[model samples]
Target: MSPTPIAWQAETVPVAGIALHLARAGAGAPVLVLHHDIGRPEPSPFDDALARSFSVLAPSHPGYDKSPRPDWMRSVRDVAVVYQWLLGERELTRDLTLVGLGFGGWIAAEMATMAPRAFKRLVLVGAMGIKPERGEIADQALLSYIDYVRRGFADQRAFDRLFGAEPTTAQLEQWDLNREMTFRIAWKPYMYGATLPHLLGGVATPALVVWGREDRIVPLECGERYAKSLPRARLAIVEGAGHFVDMEKPDELAQLVIRFVNEA
Candidate 1:
């Protein structure tokens, strides 16, 4: 298979008193991507694909990667607020699409609920933030990154592309930092905000909820719950994919995203 194209430029953009390392590319409408817990601060194949049609903004969460995390930054709500400030500071509040995956999806959902009018389109992929009435959202905190990948992807090759057979020492340290940040933000509520579902009904932004039919991490049930809670949202389940749908099915996810963003 050919390598995924690399076109984005990595740079640091100051936001909320600290600098955010982000990858930006493309030239049309803006698309902000809030990455998952395991995602790094750099652009991925998914970002590259989205950059073909839209300007992709993928930022490292405050506490993750090289970004400095303020002591006060604790919950997903806090993260969401910081992002709102970031968008406003950059004047990107209008005609923008917000895409979130896994933990990032949780933050994106919170942001949507907080502003309701900030984004033109919203996409959540295997998002976490709502407590399942029946099953449970898998606790990735307890699992090793390798184990997490194995569980998150239907195609094992996807894990190799993202994590490799063995992580370097620096990679391990970065993974630990990312995992620690994940704990700080998600451990309290165990990944769900008690009030998020109630608030989602007020979000009028059109949303597309994507999930891997066999996602063991967040589960399809959570996606269904998001679809039901959001006032205007549709759920799409990608068969043979897992929690890491973006990595496992970048082209497919990008197509869904483009279609959703283009719709009236």
Candidate 2:
């Protein structure tokens, strides 16, 4: 349980007339890390671990947290386009790996579907966007703090480490704003689409779908469905983990991702 030693630099890249905040570290092949609906990209343990071996970039999606949002940019497609622009601005055109968690995974899937050749590999962890036959993914914005803590993690102690104890007023305010933006974009279908099946089959990049065996928010069945639809995809279930598997099981999750990237 030593604190991760990776050093990250804060960057602001202009995309679609707004300055987007991005956290970056390490070197070698580029790996982009997308945060869940919770946002606040800096404290991500999974990104830190991945940065040890690869150049990792974690961007705060427009309208989330400290990132500015344009009035016209609505829908997940808009977010995906902005991310693509950001990558272009950075000149990351080859050997790109996109890894996303929860709602971020939805954005990643959309990005891959829109421009599959832009990325070399895709990793979706506890992803949402594809509609399931039964039950619905929980709208994260509506969940109370206690409810989020209970449903998001397999180990409750990981909550204090990820969210921290006695968060400052400013931190809480940012968290609220992040949740609001997430709800604004994702609340319509309760975090899914009926047309996702058609789009998923079109993604050409190799994909890795990682799900927590105990995930209640987005069921494990959804992960299986996502893998089955994609032409090049594999599914892995992490036991003793919930929706936020990366936080509760960072070491295990990192190992899985590293192996996948190497294999791909």
Candidate 3:
């Protein structure tokens, strides 16, 4: 017998004056997903897989897609605070599992540090919040669109999703807007907070750092650093994947998350 395919329920909710475009589904426990820089408000394959076990709420960050970016949202920490307000407003502070990917992981780290007691568990996939002491994070800003796409996935054929079909004008505009917001929040510190590692040490929430073994953006070492820094954190390296581990290995990542959350 085959399994049922999970579908997402979309919504536009106002949180602290911000109208957040959210995609959600499933019923058991709450899992909030903070997305990467180029992601949209709609549900991806990863979201569907996650919904099989736990209710998943994935929000497009402000200035991405239909979500509005406030003038004051200049840093990852600012978004973290807004999300804190979001969880409280939705009354989803208890028994929650928080997942962040790439750029989103940076925001999630900030949120966990700000309110360590709010969530039951945390998952960071190809996350970037701390500056690497040895290797450098890939400079996405400098790379051409094709090059960036090529480096994102372990399988280079995935680049076709971006370049194979010509993008519509609207898609191009949204890409520009998302990039602008990324620069605004991360440009100064360049994708990492100077004190983030120190703050992570104080986080008591159990966290799982999932990284792609061949990640070209944020190195695997960053995942190791995160696991070592957080009070109760561990690392899980998924093979044959790159920076977009969730996209490349959605089912595997989902199983890993399900196992972790179930154990808690």
TM of each candidate vs. truth: 0.95, 0.93, 0.94
Q: Model 2 residue 71 lDDT?
A: 65
Candidate 2 residue spans exceeding 4 A from truth: 1-4, 165-168
Q: Taking the tens digit of each residue's C-alpha lDDT, what string does model 3 give over 56-146?
A: 8888787777788877778889888888888888899899999999999999999999987778999999999889989999887898555
| Index of the highest-lDDT prediction | 1
Residues 51-86 of candidate 1: C-alpha lDDT, one tens digit per residue = 889998888898798687766667888889888988
Greater lDDT among 1 and 2 belongs to 1
Q: Provide the global lDDT of candidate 1 against the true structure.
A: 0.86
Clashing pairs in 1: none
The lDDT per prediction is 0.86, 0.83, 0.85
Candidate 3: residue 251 Cα off by (Å): 0.5
Q: Of the pair 1 and 3, which is ahead by lDDT?
A: 1
In model 2, pairs of residues that clash are: none
User: Which candidate achieves the best TM-score against the true structure?
Assistant: 1
